[model samples]
Target: MGIQEIAQATGLSKATVSRALRGLPTVAGSTVDQVRRVADELGYVPSSAAAGLATGRQRAVGVVLPVIDRWFTAKALGGVDAELRAAGYDLVLYNLGGPGGDRHRAFRRAMLRQRVDALVLLSLVLDETERRELQVSELPTVVIGGPAHDLRNVGVDDHEVAALAVAHLTGLGHREVAYVGGEDEAGFTVAVPYLRRDGFTEAMARAGAPVRADRYADGRFSFAGGVAAGAVLLEVPAPDRPTAVVCASDEMALGVVVAAHRLGLEVPRDVSVTGVDGHEYGEVLGLTTVAQDPEAQGRVAARTVVLEAQGASPGPLPPSAARLVVRRTTAGPCR
Candidate 1:
């Protein structure tokens, strides 16, 4: 059986029949369901090459993200893959290497060749030229983890996430708290680390806690970075050491805890620690943290772009939520 035969029998256009049978949202849901029923009854099958030529639509989605090996990125990809597959779309991934890896090459050279129907950008920062190129391409796009001009974005408020971590520590009567974070200013996409840092500083001031000069440290958002920052902060004599430390990410929080033990200090008893991200390790390490689900963010971003690619109009997308989780790594400061 063929599309024309199905269209003639159903009293629909061949174009409509072709689109509906393929599960493209360009057709109305009821019409699609009916078409599928007819196709099934007749045992009609679609030819892959003909369908592409007829619809001019690739059943594919492009995903751009950084650091594919990271837990957050992997989980986000998992969510994206599931959603796109359920919607009958394939995912084409582009991994931009870490800082200094020349991500612009993906935009300058590779992206145009892929001819994907839509794009989802996860935690990637675009410069002026790249942003202009993206706009000119006029592809259906969804942004995750941060903003892109006039595009739908899904993410947690970084400021609020950091504030949650600080509030948790301050509420426990810790007067001195430090922050371990990434390089918010250079070689990064958006100002996530900077926004979180600001949140911590503002929250501390509101709680009547002073962040001393020595209380701040900078490092990447990794276990090793956390360990380095942790050592710097905890190696101080007890009189000057912070009672609790807030980290920009959960991975860093775990590092700080290990640093505490190595320096002969007990968690919570000597130095309380908190971080952002509801990372998988948080439960195992008992690290208190402000939690946001990256997978859920990925799901939201994927759904948004896929629907838009299928011809649904774009609209407002509110940021995802973040909350605090208390665990064994934090307690009131030991006097």
Candidate 2:
């Protein structure tokens, strides 16, 4: 029940038991094993907060994201949660949705309370001031999707990922391909949509395809946005229509598919479509896309944070490589 009781039960000194519980390497291996077993038998759940005071480690990582409702964020969180649980760390989730009020209160103000050992920002667009605040924490931080000032990151190259999506569509004989995505004004100060748009242009140029400004439709990164955009594109006259469309996210692609079906058009026959992020539903829709390993990104981010907590330097950001997963959504030029 107490440190003395644990020590007595394990036949070890109280100091040794204490050292073992703290995970200090000074204790002998056998002593630590005996102590841990005894503690487990006693149903001892060590107080992380109390231990943090002595070790200067909270044994937890804070994860800040724009919205948890989105498919991409949910997938990324799934990966992060699994990795942290396996590594004996806690994940403190902060959904920076709504207006700037909750986000500022949670991330800018309350986060500095020293509740977590490090922070993991998942695809948030932080401004200079916000970035400075995170830096002042002096805790290890790993950003997913883009670079954070004085912090390490792990994510696919957004530009390259978009390029791959374009290249895949072009390779399928889709010359007149349209791009559908929304503006990057969702959260924070980063310009992800703009970067992805640049990537799309670059990819189209390399493929010798026409990147029509009119072909690009801005929409929300949701199923409904996709449907609306899809309707607009489908409304075009047959001769003026693009043979294929590339969506910025999987949800958008699903919308395109629905729109095509509504117009009595068969996917890849009447019009081909592709998407990024490789959502679970993409397979059911047979949508072609570039798969970025969200789970792997989460694990790497967690490991980076944990290492930083242990006084290790955060490594360079990981590269974003796109692996094409072809399905029924895209095909050669319309017959």
Candidate 3:
């Protein structure tokens, strides 16, 4: 039923009904209660678009991600979705995947169409032109896991996450540990893999552990990539082989686990493994990791963008941090 019918049933004016439905302070609390009761009885639903037009907002925020299939990205997006919905906002997802050509075209043609009030970019590696295009919207934008730019962003220090992984292995009595990470450096321009590697090196140095150049492997941030890295790591001669491995993501860690089992190497008993990003499967694998609340990050980014759209300054975006979560993935040095 329409607002007018609800108003008639409640014996309230249409204006008062609209105000009550919107939960405006101008409407008396009793009248709002009465309107809500009658509206519920009639199964009335308000049009968010109509309300948005009246308020000069769409009540919707846009989220752009490089790929939706990855675990980390999906988890982060999930968090953003919960936070925005709780605040009476909607999210519009934009997947900007593909090579530079298709990605650039999507950004220019579709994402900047002024459809969303504000934008949240999740782990999207935007070039100079794309950054300029985003700025053209003049909408409040928050970026997650992004390079340092003029726009506000929220994400953990990737380097620190990597360091924690490596540090945990070293602390578990592992002197010879290998680091594996993604080969694509485009996303690393924001210092993802490189910083993570830096953290690993720093941790090893601090622990006085030996750093083996051959132990470091570069692969994609996928299960196959992890398998490839694990194969190479397991191939090192017996005495020189790394007793532990540090992976950039849990997906890679799982791959390593699978590879280890195939190679007849038992985890934690023969060799230990740790990873970054507290994926759901990490607990199942008993993988030690550095956990960052991806959902919380998404929520914060959404809130920041919404506030910006409302012409309210959200101040500066807070720097994200990582915490170490110890699990059964690492153990004492093998004799």
Candidate 4:
């Protein structure tokens, strides 16, 4: 059985029956129910390939990511999946596989193919070649976690997120502070870490606690990286050491806590620590942090791209929100 038989039985045109079967918004609810009932009664199974050929839409969205294993990436992917599931759209994920992955080939071979109707890029700053390729493809695109040169993005104001963390620490009267952050090891020049680092510097300066030259260490945005950087910042003479530390991620903050423990320092007594991104481990470890919702950002990006792909004009998206979540890791400097 097919759409033709269903159409004949329902006394509707084949076009209307097809649209109804595809669940196009233009079809009325009652008409959709009628068409579906007829199709089911006739034991009709709709072919996705036939539908795609008929409508010139693949009914799928592509999500391109620099990596797949990070906490932010996983959460955001879940959000995109949830929104796409609701919209009856499929998700096609393209993982770059970290550093040395053939991004050029991936862009040319996988994305340029007519597989997905829209695209969502996660935290990638496209190069000129990549940008031109995207333009050539003419796919409706949305970015999450970082701003692309000319594309719409859905993520928190990273600078402001860092400033919130800085303000929280400074308000507690901590003057000497160290910073832990770094770029992606996969060699993608992500903007989030740079923005957060700049925000930390500016906020500290504004609070009259200008960061010292030696107080900065690259945490590499990983727990192990954080441990290495944390030791460099904390294993110092008492007067020379920073009284508080601010990390770009909760994973790094947790690493700092571990490094502190290894060095026989008591948190909030010998030194205080804070982080960004409300990682679950942060709660377990009682780490103060400024939290932003990556999952919500993902949902927004998916929804926006899907709408644009469907020929809907959406307005510029406002930046996502971030706020301070204080816990036991921060305190006033020791007297």
lDDT of each: 0.79, 0.76, 0.75, 0.85
Candidate 4 regions with alpha-carbon error over 4 angstroms = 1-56, 187-189
Better of 2 and 4 by TM-score: 4
Q: What residue pairs are clashing in model 2?
A: 125-189, 156-320, 157-320
Best by TM-score: 4
Over 1-335, each residue of candidate 1 has an lDDT whose tens digit, in order, gives: 68888898899999898778666778899998787667656656355533342353777888887667777778888889989888888898877766666565455332333347778887777778778767655667887766656666788988899888887888888988999997632233456877888888999899988688789997588888899989999999887888899999898899999999999999999999998889988888788998888888889888988887767888878879888999999999878
Error of 3 at 227 (Å): 0.9
Q: In candidate 4, list every pair of residues with a backbone clash.
A: none
Backbone clashes in candidate 1 total: 0
* Sort by TM-score, top down from the best: 4, 1, 2, 3
Q: Write the per-residue lDDT of candidate 4 for residues 1-335, one digit (tens) a residue.
A: 67788888999999999888767899999999898767655646445533342353788888888889999899999999999999999998888888766575456543454457788988886889899878867777888987778788898898998888889888989888999999868544478889999999999999988888899999999999999999999999799989999999999999999999999999989999999999988998799999889999989998998887777775799999898999999999985
Note each model's CA RMSD in angstroms. Answer: 11.1, 10.2, 11.1, 10.4
Give the local distance difference test score of model 3. 0.75
Q: Give the TM-score of candidate 1.
A: 0.80
Candidate 2 lDDT over 1-335, as tens digits, reads: 57888987877888888888766789888877777667756645445433453364567788888777766677778888998999898888888883363566445432444567777887776667677767556667787766555556687777877888887777777788888888544563254566677899888988888588889987577788899999999778787888898888888889999988998888888899888887989987788988887778888888877876776755666585568898888888764
Once fitted onto the true fold, the runs of candidate 3 whose alpha carbons sit more than 4 angstroms away are 1-56, 104-106, 109-112, 184-190
Q: Please tell me which predicted candidate would have the highest lDDT against the true structure.
A: 4
Error of 3 at 292 (Å): 1.6
